[model samples]
Target: MPSSIFINQLYRPPSSSSPETLPSPNTGVRAFHQSLPGYKPSPLVSVPAIAARQGIRWCLVKDETERLGLPAFKILGASWATYRALGERLGLRENGDVVSLQRLAEAAKAEGVVLFAATDGNHGRAVARMAGYLGVGARIYVPSLLDEEAISKIRGEGAEVVVYDGDYDQTVLATKVAAENHAEGKGVLISDTALTVDDETANWIVEGYQTMFDEMEEQVLEITGTRTITHVVTPVGVGSLTQAVVTHFQRTPRSPKPMVIAVEPKSAACLKASLEAGEMTSVKTEYTICTGMCCGTLSAIGWPMLKSGISAAVAVEDSDVDTATKNLQSCGINAGPCGAASLAALESLSSGEELALGPQSVVVLLCTEGRRGYEMRSNSQPEP
Candidate 1:
């Protein structure tokens, strides 16, 4: 499929009296993250080369390559949601101490409580890692098309990896059913995506991503001595992370709220399709190198926010992602195909005036993952 970009006609700023609002800089979530081992803010880097090539003042990347010892930002959402979902059952308190967490792990193990989740890659590994921290077990479900390296990483975290013979959305349903049917050991679903907007666990997962933006805002201020971010480019899998971007930039009282551009694989551009249809729509996704963004459907909870808040949606072909990966790697930023999709989207949008990016514009690309191995679906060689 050819690459395309859609300007959201429904895009509008948040009204001062709007009831739909997500809180900014959630301190409690940040504090919880700070208490975890290997906790530190991911770097917000300015790539001058990219900015010059793209004709922007600065092209900043919020590098999530090494967040909490994981290769992606999925850990931020998975860990936070797991804590909120199973905290009481495992006797965990806010900012729970390491010793108390260890003791509660033993209690949780005796009680047979387990964490259940489905992912293309990063989220499942994160859930398994969280399960290890709490001395419980985890069962991670993945689509049959996922790469072996991703599956191996999840299994290495001591979780049982189940292969579902379907796409990502179907795998999520299978995982939900398995979690619901595991009558012996208590299973708690810690999914980040949902079929309905009211899924509490999914909402909590969205809340868990607050720390990333909080850190980005502080870092941007420290580096630029200003808070005038004109654009935030984010990759959309199920739209949960895009929802977080809109919540952080739109809800702020800051004037001229940053325009959010959501990027997705051309074959799996579900959010872009939904935005053009003026209603939530699902598409049949084809194979793409950006496996992480290969979701076929949009999260219901994120539709309203994304449709109204996102300035534009860009869907890029695998070749575009390959070029982006090479560009980022040349700069010593080990961004995978999915993570580099934001750069590709920016390139697509910059070709026209839809974005209105200027010399003073400081664009932040949310690079959600580091480089990983994957088979090339196109005729071109796989990203190195």
Candidate 2:
């Protein structure tokens, strides 16, 4: 019920038996991304102050605060998945040179395609932005609990925003049904998470996320002159990004694959619950400032790999995230609650020796978003 860590007992060393359909270390997804306009690698920052405090050899932060003109890394997956999905429908070459957003817009407009998606915030906005690039219509669905600022951003992209009267999981189902029932038969659901394992678009979304990890590895090598990242702490929503993290590290030729650590809001610790149950499990979530991570279910496509791939799972309280956000800000890292959750997880580990991280351990915290507005937990609680 409080901030806690679960060291996975079923964890195994990286194996070769992972699903072949998912992204691999050798994929051309990054190449595809490189062809997009305004494509640049996000910064990998050294937080020496935190490193010294935590007694770790290095504490690195992959700053995805601003990626591709978006405030979060969700655009990485959204853009790539959008391109791939459109390319398939339009008979465009996969991994072919993307001439420009305008050219893609022309082609997609000629094809009568419309994008449909559900989001807590960032992912839906990314999807809508991509639809705008393609000159296509988009309808974004959101849970009733999403903040108005996020909903407005989605609408700003010229996408019709539909507020679902339920939680994120229900919103996803509503989007799927809406896409399927599109009267014009032109709706394409570009979802990052899926209820089924073999959803092609969902798989592409997972593949799209490899660009972030690829860039992180290159930056880590540049800093250490070797692939020395021993632990990767990631904030988990539906686990798509974390799945990308596990796949990249597991398949990397680096001598030892980095230990994968997943962090989520304590109220929405579905992955941790599933890991403990030795089967996929869902949780009833409550309000958390880490709104992007307030998902109640583990992504079905990611569950198999995450079952054995992750070394540890952490669930942090909103108060912990508030403190982490302030720490990151003091370090000049403008991170939102979701972005700061990785730091919160690290600090949770530092309070005890559960992970046994020592001076030799080199850790990378994936900060996935920039600063955003949210009520602080301390202020949100009613006075006794």
**Residues 1-384, candidate 2, lDDT per residue (tens digit)?**
433889998888675544465454536678877866688999999999999999998999999899888899998889888887777767666356444556667888987888999999999999998887778999999998888888998899899999999989999999999998986778889998989988888888888888888788789889988888888999999999998888887766775667899999887899999999899999977778888888999889999999999999999889999999999999989999999999999998853455658998899999998999887655356422
Steric clash pairs (candidate 2): none
- lDDT score for residue 158 of model 2: 92
What C-alpha root-mean-square deviation, in Å, does candidate 2 show against the real structure? 2.7
Candidate 1 structure quality by residue, lDDT tens digits, 289-361? 8988889998889998888989899998898898999998888789999899999998876544667797888
In candidate 1 the C-alpha lDDT for residue 85 amounts to 76
Write down the TM-score for model 1.
Answer: 0.93
Cα lDDT of candidate 2 equals 0.86
lDDT of each: 0.86, 0.86
